[model samples]
Target chain A: MLKTSLSKLTIFILTGFLMVFFIGMSIVFGYTNTSIQLAYEAFTQFNESNEHLIIRTVRLPRALIAAACGASLAITGVLMQTLTKNPLASPGILGINAGAGFAVVLSITIFHISSLQAFAWISFLGAGLAAICVYVISSAGTGGLTPMKITLAGSAISAMFSSLTQGILVTNEAGFEQVLFWLAGSVQGRKLELLAAVSPYLFIGWTAALMIAPRMNVLAMGDDVAVGLGLKLGRIKIFTGIIVILLAGSSVAAAGPIGFIGIIIPHIAKKIIGLDHRWLIPYSALLGASLLLAADIAARYIIMPREVPVGVMTALIGTPFFIYIARKGLSQS
Target chain B: MSKYYSFRILADKISFLIDKKAMIKIGFLALLTLLIFIISAGLGGMPINPLHVLQVFFGGGEDMERLVVMQFRLPRIMVSIFAGMALAVAGGILQGMVRNPLASPDIIGITAGAGAAVVAFLFLFSDHNHSLTVSIKWMPAAAFIGAAIVGFSVYFLSWRNGVTPVRLVLVGIGIAALMQACTTLLMVTGPIYRAAEANIWITGSVSGSSWEKVQILAPWTIILLIIAFLSTRTINVQELGDEVAIGLGSSVERQRFFLLLISTCLVGGAVAFAGGIGFVGLMAPHMARRLVGSSFDALLPTSAFIGAVLVMLADLIGRTAFGPLEVPAGVFTAAIGAPYFIYLLVKTK
Candidate 1:
């Protein structure tokens, strides 16, 4: 583990560099296959050629959305793990993503609203409602939110929302075509303006996550220990909860309900750096951004001309890691 | 009045006590299930009267009525009811063996595994004309194999010394996500028509169920239900927690494996015919518990009847409620089951 702050900072900067490199890879490669020179020219010199337009409009926004959503989801994962004290807890597993996706689909099919801003607010409302429902349901019993209880509660809620979403899609075929890729969780075809709508919430979530990293360290050391140390447990939890909703909700709004990045990146960060949230949070963001950018790039190539959604790519990658963690037992966290 | 009725045979070599109140509740549920079956059968596109459904049953109806009732309605009704019964029984076994109220077949990935397999089967077997190259009759077999494969994998993967309930559940969740991902991947890559067809199946419908499906699923489900019913004692013992059950000289792991197998087979048979009918397993058992306490013998039968009723009603509403759209029964079940699930979570203490 990196004991010295200098070493942690060095590695953190290195990861940020790696993230930038992957972002570049994401931009340069796709179905159209632009070069670094072409990508550079697209930004520096505006000639509206087919490749340049694809580079400037299509590739860059997708890359940014993937990076931002990945980072947000990963930070959300760190906060969720700390808040629930469950290693397996993430927005997707806990139904926040499904809830947000469900809200978007519901509005699309029912109200026919396609506005990006509407998606942002609707997803936040959905994510917040699901989070509260899960918390309330799991906390209702005697033990007050055991990991098992919360996991079950979350999975149940996730199933409910997804099934309901399927119901709507089954009934409305046109809406089905419109929302299928989004529901499958992709960072493709999203415009910069789409990212622009939810970035402010994403910014607040990132800033708040970094700010609370120290208290999260205390909170991670068991509830009794944190209480003995005079942290206002309830307020901190609510604060973290809002941040989670903001981060997870906005990302789902932007790129559908991408799975597994949140759960996978936090653990990867914890493994590289120790459990210190201060370093872990930033490291996780970089790793998450890099991993998703890499996945998004790979997603383009996996199915030839047809792109498999990046969400499916991450799920394909993440399930094995998830099973390994599960097999290692819950106490390993 | 005594609450217990004891049945004995072969000089007390076999004896079991039945709860009178539970028996009464089961009887009532069975009647309710019959009512739903008849109502659903009678109220489809033709809308035969419920009284005329019984008349058709006794071979007294016209040819068109026979075609609609005998050829069309009965098979789908039977499929849904039997599938529902199988799912509820499987779910009851799971909740008991896992010692968790929230445990169900879908939550643990059985239904999803079957769904992925079915979708993959459709995608793989279809020719350039978008029709199956092989007989679609083999889809159930594919679904069964898929559910068994995933069920055993979850059990074996969670096996560290022995499979703890928490580990099994966690592993199952991971596997479930993977299966869902697979389903989505296949759907997206396939034609949009295929995606729509698969979506209807994934959301689960009994619309196209034929007598052939009923014939296969009925015997499979009935045999599993009987086996499940006979194993109620083992499930009851396991429900007391693993340590206690082991202390009582029960082969806890072996019994758990046995119970898990039964649940998987039941779920496989159900999913094979009905597709991924969500939440019937979860909802039925809990509703049964409310009706007839927590005893396995009472709970199992009660849950089966309630499940049959629930799915039959869901199918009923699906076909009848939405004007010509024909929503899948799984949708209605989720509509009711999700809220009830939240309530169960809240009341889980």
Candidate 2:
């Protein structure tokens, strides 16, 4: 047992080390003329030179957005799985991303609203509305919010919102570019101001999620047992719903609908640390951030001078791993 | 006088049998569908007068009116019907196979595969000037190949000693995520123009569909429909679970493989023609099951008809509701079908 625990600890440390190494690599690599050594110097000295501007202003912000977006999405996934007690539950599953995308599309096309701050607020509102809608729809019948029911309701809502967004785009030629970019789920051209704007909400969401980890543990045991243990099931559900909206909304606002990170990362973390949410949440956050940052780094260099959306890279890497975990989980269950 | 009394008695018996609860409900739904279809066909922009449409159908209209009705509107209508029917059949087969109402073509990675393949084509070939011949011949082939890859991957990955529905679904989701990721990568890195074109296609559209597309799709759709029909017996037996199916002398593995292959073909063919239209494959089977009973034999036909009707109505709305600037048929179907699907989900259990 001691040897096994020690080996697990070793793996954890290695993952942590890999995360830091990748972040450094992301800072060093770029599409421009600057060599790796020069890039390092520019990064460390806060150089105001042209090369420094390209590295610090352009590449760094993009990488940071990727990391932050990825980590938040993965954490949201962990919360969703725990709260809904369904392995398939993710932020995308609940239509939050679609709602946010629709709101952004409306702002751009119909309302002619262009400010990033306004877009963020609109996305948050849309996400909140979508979650409430899912909750109400799923809880309507007698068996009150079974995992399967919520999954179905979420898919239906997602379909509806995404269709509406697509309808608007197809009908109006002006909104096409905006919709296309948003739909691709990129982390390019983001500003630190945008990141700062979304940070408070992310912090509050993360804190709330951590605080509820113990309750989630009990909740996972089954609703009746959790209720018997004096947990208010309704309150917990509402709280988690809000947290999902905040996390998912802010992430979407910052960097479009980067998906699969939220769906795949938590499953990976769970395999490493078992079902305990305390470890799962933190581990998923770190791992998700690391994974996204690495993918973003690859995105920049893969097609030099052109970038792939970080979302796509994550999907490629995360999907195979996700498939493996799901298969394993199914067999054991 | 006694003979007249016997005739009245016979009439009463016939009425009583027709007015039984199940029959009345089915009749009502059928009537409602007809009403929707008629209204939809008449409501589109550049409206062909209902009378003119009828006259054209009967070979009595002016050439100009007949051309408009037959060449443009008729093909659009036919494509929508074919797409809807194919998707619904695929959904019914999948849901029955999985024993999960949520199982749809998209959920199983077929849609994602098609989407990814289209994006790859746009990226790799957008720069070439050989437009007409290349697009007509190669586009559908690309979609088919992509869909086959994803479907086969999901099936193989999910198969251990034997395939299970739950494992299949889970693996499909994983493969879908991967395919989506590849799609995004292509969109982001490829030329902006190509990405834009691919994006529009991915959301789905039946706007520019021609007779050629219809011809390409019809044979596969008919063949797959027959396959779905034949598999219904095995599907019903499998619903009793694998142990019982085996005991009853059914080759569960072979049956499942064939059914999945047929479903993949249906989805791939429809998507090749119409892009990744959402919701019909997911919602049609559930609605059909509710209308008829769960027997796959009955459910498949009902779902196909309902699916076709839904797509036709959606196409009509897509063309007419906004006027001139048409929404894709895909968007319309999702808007209409998703809410109803949600209602079903909430009400069923």
Best by lDDT: 1
How large is the interface RMSD of each prediction? Answer: 1.2, 2.8
lDDT of 2 by residue, B1-349 (tens): 2211111245442211121344455556567656555455445655667776777778888887777777777776767777888999999888878877778988778988999998887677755552433454588789888988888999999989889987887787667667777877776666656765676677777777888888878878988897787667777877778888899998999999888998999999888878888889998888888776787766787788788888888777777877677777887777777777777876775
Write one digit per residue (lDDT tens) for candidate 1, span B192-273: 8888998998898999899989988988899989888877878888999988899998899998999999999999999999
Candidate 2 docks at the CAPRI level of medium
In the order shown, what is each candidate's alpha-carbon RMSD?
1.4, 5.6
Residue-by-residue lDDT tens digits, candidate 2, A1-333: 112556656766777787777766776666666667777887678669888888887777776777778778989999888887777678776678878877878888999987877877898898887887787787776776666566656765765787778677766766776666567677778888888888888899889988988888998898899999999998998898888888899998988877778877887787787777776787788888888887788877777777777767666776776677667754664
Clashing residue pairs in candidate 1, if any?
none
Regions of model 1 farther than 4 Å from truth: A331-333, B8-15, B347-349
* Interface RMSD (Cα, Å) for model 2: 2.8
